[model samples]
Target chain A: MRLIAIFFGLIFLLVGFRNNQSIELIFPSSWPEPIYNDDNYPLNEQKVELGRALFFDPQLSSDNTISCASCHSPYNAFTHVDHQLSHGINDRIGTRNSPAIFNLAWQKDLMWDGAIHHVDAQALAPINHPDEMGSSINEIVQKLNKDVRYKKAFKSIYSDDLITGERVLKLLGQFMISLVSCDSKYDRVMSGKDKFDEQEKRGYELFCKNCSECHKEPLFSDYSFRNNGLEPDPQLKDIGRMKITQNRMDSLKFKVPSLRNIEFTFPYMHDGRYKKLTEVIDHYDRKIHFSNTLDPILEKGIHFTTNEKVDLVAFLLTLTDKNFMFAPEHGYPKDFFDQK
Target chain B: MIRSIQILILFFSLGVRAQDSIPVKVMYDRFEIQPGKTILFQDDSIRIDVVKFYLTNVVVGGSELSSGLLFDLEKDQNYLLIPISQIDEIQFTLGVDSLTNSNGISGGILDPIHGMYWSWQSGYINFKLEGIHFENGIAEEFNFHIGGFLNGYNCERRIQLQGSSNVSRLELDLYQMLQTLSTDQLKKIMSPGKRAMDLADILADSFFLR
Candidate 1:
């Protein structure tokens, strides 16, 4: 226990002090280095705290009703589990499933379509989205600037009282990048701390055989757009990535989702078409769509036995991290609202 | 895959950037706009209207091109003010800058505004046009919302300015755009199909420098 304490202390010292700011950057050694540079966007404790406060604060929305925590609940891997499709201010339902937002430091693009290139600019989407928060960054900052608590918080970290849109964006990025999920059973197994059960191990082996090509390990996503063999929803008519490229060849291809916490984040796909993991697996096993733009990988569905499917479900369950899900530190900082 | 990919993309986000030290201010439009007064133009005035088309891209007549941050003169505010210039000659696209279009954006550019978004069916409104024209002695309001972000009609228009840079104030002569199209051509465009494509092509060709 003493040895463990000292080891943790050493890690805190090394990673906790980046860019002269005290941000806790203690992901496991086995994980790859983060994509976001601390030098450009410093990760201070004050900034992280501010970002956390902002995440829970509804002032970022047009009305004081919606916040980041609304769609992305902390308990459910920072993504709402109750709703298949996410809801925002005035009960507006967004089409896409709210993705599990962990290990973002390794992510290059955001959203199901990978539309947002930077995490800094990512919040601006939900904030000003008419069907979402529907609040402008300018408007949100103006609200924060007027509030004495936020003004003090801003002054403590950024040194000035001005709450510009860029600062809001950068701070939100800091908080989001900090949401690293390196405590899954897969991570523990790789770290040599925990062992996978026989069923889970077999499921993982099957996963490696069939899913690992696109849903790559470590991060569990190759992050490329692929036509995952699902037929397009007739009502939505979303053309996936072809909207960005204007190329017919790229039609029906959406961003390959990260299957890290697939056990929790359900109502899957861009349109929230599949409600169950078994259904999703069955679709992959049988409903391989034959089209001009279907992913070659999914041209032929993988055949899985009934028992193997149960084993797969067992492996998927190992991804849930109770420590992370119930970390008291990430819960609503009651102290934040006290001053406001 | 994510690590190496992130490195490549990080290089781009960092590399494709202006000097970071100077948080400069760009006065988008200053002299062209006067508060408390709405500017008026003739139906026959030579006008060029530019929109920072969101969902779609900007291409010239045949090729995709860069969209510069040319300021709007009639109204001067520090926002992403759309530019309106005289019809001496013009060149411009209705989409984003090259680096931005390549890397992509989340909210500001792609944020849903007006009635341009196609619900959740598609993503963004790549182009928008609002024009008032004389049709059969009736002044009809014509609105062209062209965008789909993905697939065909990804109209990231490229434009070339033909006129010399003059004073601070620039004018939008609607008449110039009107001169290019007769009442018959103007009356036909509704969506980005064949006829709408022809009007878009005319609008693309109408861009010149003054």
Candidate 2:
């Protein structure tokens, strides 16, 4: 085993010498360590660029219409805002809303129900969903293998043009792991770079007191599944975590999404029932339908006056990192695709 | 230093050592299964288009042969050269375990591109048997994509078989698996659940050392 390790080590160094496009994860030092480790899955600039191109390419779908960016647009923190529930190819509607994608390196589980445990494997869900992309990794790889551009890109990175499901999925994972959103107003305030105004200050206190338990600070989420007291939609009848676990206690429990970029990633919640951030606050304030699996912290129903509600919204708005949403590198790779 | 040398020696002498290994040939019954060929079974005839299964943690003579070996009877040769002299007892899991499922995507036979993986959910289809099952002069298609790694629903079964030194084959009776299925299970099984678990048990039970 040691001999093999040394042999592989020599090959790794030789490969590393050939490729000088390796990148590093850049985020606030004060933030907790991201769950994604670079030991097994290293970050590379070329691979990330390849992943970004795949992210925006519609060829990934069965009919070559819907891409990952169709629902997860970079402008809306990688989430669609036009529809409450996400729609896909042939105008077919999915059951749940498309959640925002940022700071995913810290996320332990993907999707509202925490079904996908790995970031690399998360793309399979929508890609294979009949209502969504309606495509398989096998089908996508066959198409990608035929494309000269994909062949060239893969050859440049892997030193060969062999495109497989593992490479495609891992490349997508590389791009997702690269998405780090820490430069919010709240982050600046915490770092002593900026100060909150009177209204914002009061709202921050309320958030810390009431919301911080589940939507924990720093990352803005503890990444635990919880029934935050949204009454189950009669039509959807989506039994969130229970579908995965098959346990009665996990019924109606969905993953607590990060509130970062909360201003843009609306229609909120698992089913996207709440449209505005104000409506989301109002749900907690008044409309929390108690159930057996409802989050115990929200059982008592925190009462915030209209004035306090406005202040809370003010603080929530500060969580938006405009730089992340509008990052030129994160946008559609027009130049990459426009090339002959 | 000693361990490193031992490993280097073991690696270099693998080809020489493999001569002593036992060759285990897989069979449908008394005959080898040919893809796309109609075969007689009890009172009916069935044509197997695809028969794929994962034989994981293949242990022969207390030595593990492979971590996971995906067997595609249509695509692969119907034999395994297990790296052991004589098999007193052989033990292996009939499906990919929960640990591999939780670890996510991997390369080689475990890759999701093999079509053994479920895209909507995160798991591998341990045993995939798709064929036309003929019953009472009626032809019907059957697709049993059995797999689940979740608690209470995990379909992987640890199977052990005892054999003498002369035993050169392991036979799996597809007819036995067909007998275990109910009318509802004869059509299709796409997802993991109680039904998949039941089918996995039947698939595991179908194998015997000869």
Candidate 3:
């Protein structure tokens, strides 16, 4: 109870800074510090509102077909829950899954391959991918320049100016990084306010022994590249990190993902192959695919009984953060664009 | 004394070791641009601005060049730096460092109308030249976007002077380049592969920091 009060008190301090556009969440006291230093791009509600509008707006696309929300739906933890692969404009299918986007401020790299080196530049991949938004920054800028509201948004933060690509990318990155989801049920247990049940306790112990090295504690990812024994797809054939550097040794290696709220962000992996966590564990136990670049953690798969799988699933379920998922402040900013 | 060696040498190796903060300024020497060619102005075609270059470790020769560049502290300023005794004083290529193209966007430097950006692609334009060309008495307009970020053909480079002086600028005579490279070669280079290499090599050979 004291921990929860302290958490809310810190949240209040952040909110006191909110009117100045600085309401960053204080992750549980135990979690490691975030990689995102908000000092460079301080939180501004006006910019975030503008960024959210741009995020949900189709005007960013070349042909008015898809926004970022097209593939990564907010209701599904910002991931496309049904489709195995991401679909973009013209209903064109992409090669990989639209990974859930939150807790990004802690991420050192982005994209399945870490191809887009900078967070500011990540939007360009989806915006310009032929199968995705299919838009050019020049063409997009010309459109935004004409919109009266966008011009107003641009003027409010930046001085009298034309809407440039840089402003759009930077503002959008600010909003994305602000989507931190650190207050889950698992977080409460870790803070010691509440204890896990017997099943959850057993599962937590098993997970610590089996998965904590790669999917480490607190943030649940080591942020290093590893190959988890999945074979390359014949068609998609994504080289993961290797594609970015063109290094043969990095073949099949991928960034280990955070397990925070993993229950909601399903059909997992770089390709969205397993629709359920059971299949993922099953692959680990019996269906371990062979590859030279496989992560040593899965070299000899761990066999779990059905009860163990159930317990593991129970442990993963504790990661859901209803506070972050439905926070009113993060919802669509009705004040800014509520149609006066 | 041991700690002092670590601190002084650490800061000193960058040639920019804070020698009372030398102030350098770039001004257009003015050259006419013509057909059949392009000029590089930034590190990538995606985020274009020749004025804002990141000065990383600065060193002038052989082993010094490698160690210096590999360890630059990265100063955020505009304009390229050419070491003295590296090249002829009359030429320069107009774009970003080769490694910068592949490094992709990391900072707050991607403004579009500055005319040197391609946010969708992972690189910046090394050179951007657009004008009409004339080939075999035929008039033709040309646009060249020469930049290779992922591929080894990356073309952003800085030239050093033949004498002892630290300076680099391309006072473009766009007219001279048009007159030099026939308009036919101008229209051929577009999406930053081999053709970009040839044109960028030409611009690199031409530049010297005077």
Each prediction's RMSD over C-alphas, in Å, is 11.9, 4.9, 12.1
Native contacts recovered, each model: 0.05, 0.67, 0.36
In model 2, state the lDDT of residue B65: 71
- DockQ sort, best first: 2, 3, 1
Candidate 1 residue B107 Cα shift, in angstroms, is 15
- DockQ for every model, please: 0.07, 0.44, 0.19
- For residue B80, model 2's alpha carbon misses the true position, in angstroms, by 2.2
Per-residue lDDT tens digits for candidate 3, residues A263-322, read: 888889989899999998888888878788888778888889999988888898888887
Task: List candidate 3 segments past 4 Å from native.
Answer: A1-20, A23-25, B1-94, B97-123, B127-156, B162-203, B208-210
lDDT of 1 by residue, B106-184 (tens): 3333433233333323333444555454544565555555543333444455655444445232233233334434545
Give the Cα-based TM-score of candidate 1 against the true structure: 0.70
Task: Tell me the lDDT of model 1 at A72.
Answer: 83
Model 2 misplaced stretches (Cα beyond 4 Å): A1-14, B1-49, B61-63, B66-68, B83-89, B131-143, B183-190, B193-195
Candidate-wise lDDT, in order? 0.63, 0.85, 0.65
| Model 1 CA deviation exceeding 4 Å by range | A1-19, A22-24, A37-39, B1-134, B137-210
- Which has the higher DockQ value, candidate number 1 or candidate number 3? 3
Clash count, candidate 1: 41
Question: By summed lDDT, which 10 consecutive residues of candidate 1 chain B come out lowest?
Answer: B19-28
Compose the digit string of candidate 1's lDDT tens values, residues A1-340.
Answer: 4555687798676554433666667787766777766665557777887888898899888989998988887787888776767888999987767888887778766677766656776787788678789887667877988999988888766546877666776778778877777688888888888999999999999988988999887778888888888887787787877655546877888888778777777778777778888998999999888889888887778889999999988888887776676676666768989974
